[model samples]
Target: MKNYIVILLTLITALVSAQSTRKYSNEFMNIGVDAAALGMSNAVVSHTADVNSGYWNPAGLVHLEDNQLSLMHSSYFANIANYNYIGYGMSLDDRSAVGISLIRFGVDDILDTTQLIDDEGNINYDRISTFSTADYGLTFSYARKLPLDGLNFGVNAKIIRRIIGDFASSWGFGLDAGIQFENNSGWKFGIMARDITTTYNAWSIDEEKFEQISGAVDGQNQELPETTEITIPKLEIGMSKKWIFNYDYSLLAAANLNVRFEENNDIFSTSFASINPALGFEFGYTDLVFLRGGVGNFQNERQIDDSENLTFQPNFGVGFKYKGIQIDYAFTDIGDQSAALYSNVFSLKIDFSIFR
Candidate 1:
């Protein structure tokens, strides 16, 4: 037990320092997947037990009762960006499971005006072209039950791909590990460590295309951008419990503490770290219909008058399940209690059983 405690502290403290640091690198992957989770302000880490768990806490994949497939889609920034996800999970045996997931976040049809002014000094409308910028993540996960009852651990291998039209592209790799434990009293706890190895993205730029716009702006784009980007490690811990009333109505409440190495506007902050708390609740009736709500993304914002104010985002959602198929919808604010508009997120899940 002492050894375990020491290891835990080491993991937490070791993350306090970062090398080759680039904050918010590979950020698109953090936008999250699954409407059910987004509806809960992304507080489902402890109790995620479906195909989507491949993106949340892969340990939960061990709880899959059968083969499953999941898909989700959402639009952000008033439809300027689109995000999509697909996942599959299957139990290898009573004690192990495997999962695979793919995610894409992209902005399409962006007009490129670099060549608008032709070599002859004429403004040619036809020179304007459209292109897309996108990021993709593919993950493979595996989970196994530990010798200790109710304990499970999982690991993920992630491949990241990013593209900017034909001008630039990058490939990155990372690893994630997670553990989940449930007690006899119906309480659950979990921890997830993301990018534990400090993921790196190495870019390959198109010199010809870059040179065309190198002088478009004075003193900008004159030098090639950094060829390498790094993403530091982050941690999240969660706890949850569920209650059933009259064996018909049920409620599950969960909370998560998200920790980052650098100090920021999170609810709790220090020079070396910051902690953000998220709360989520789901109410179910007859195991067929569900209602969910949550509030998270707490931040300390500086007012126009130089004062600080606390703010957060609120989310709500509904879900229906029947005959192994489930559909969920969520209304959420992508911005952290800012002026940005809300977005609609939808997800679908299907379970397959050999007997069925």
Candidate 2:
């Protein structure tokens, strides 16, 4: 118990003292917060107690005492946009599991655009074109524990689509692989790799720049606009570790390090990015209810200015169970440069289990 306090304090101090980091190269608006929050605490790998096991470390499914079902959702405080997610899972037998999850992101409403013209003296108006943008994805997963006691793994695949009215309707696909380590004391370790392969091939508009129009002897002569495809790169590697105490209590902490193979400046570019780490904790009473609180972005600040510091973003939540359903809610920092300051996330999960 005393060690727990020291650990928390050490983490808090590190988070406060570390530099802030940022990364680019991915989107789908990052609604994958189940394991994400746990990962923040570095507790997901070893804390296997729910169907969310499928989302964290598929190998955690072996912790299932019975078959289970689950659902999760989150709202990102980014860009005045709305982000949400839902997931479900069940044990196939004593050694296997399967599930599916969906994520949707609503970019803030965009004002419709139209072209208009008026004669020198007469008033005239006309609509040339109109458009908006939205993005979404669906993921399917399958995982099972091998005969090995300390080793377990799983895989997930995603299909994605993006629609920007009258501009581009893009399509992409990606995959995720995860593993968990479970020991008697409930010490946990997890690793997940996301976005190994993805590319967008259905775009035709560049909102940033336009080609010059030239006047020819024949004004009737005109050139069509040039179109290009934007590519989405692979994001790799995250690990988390957690400890479950004398049954009702637990401690979790984690850090995320992003891999960059290129440099970028666009809002979502892979360049101009950086790595980060965070710490968090959880408490429960009698195995029926739990409360969790912590802060993130331990290593995410500018390096040169010791004078300017960013607050450690905090997260808090409570969870309960009714029959086979697991309900969870959390409050976190949205940190969107374009949106309001605070944001909230709620997740629900159902688990189905079968034991000998």
RMSD of each: 2.0, 9.5
lDDT score, residue 287, model 2? 57
Give a tens-digit lDDT track for model 1, residues 21-104: 555689998988888898898998899988988889999999999999999999988899999999999999999999999999
Q: TM-scores, in order shown?
A: 0.95, 0.67
lDDT of 2: 0.52
* Candidate 2 ranges beyond 4 A from true positions: 1-25, 35-49, 53-55, 61-69, 72-80, 115-132, 198-274, 299-311, 334-340, 352-356
Estimate every model's Cα lDDT from 0 to 1: 0.88, 0.52
Query: For residues 106-184, what per-residue lDDT tens digits would candidate 2 score against the true structure?
Result: 6655643223332233333443344456677777777777666766777777777777665456666666566665566
Candidate 1 local lDDT, residue 26 = 94
lDDT score for residue 27 of model 1: 90
TM-score, model 1 to reference:
0.95
Which 10 successive residues of model 2 have the least lDDT summed? 208-217
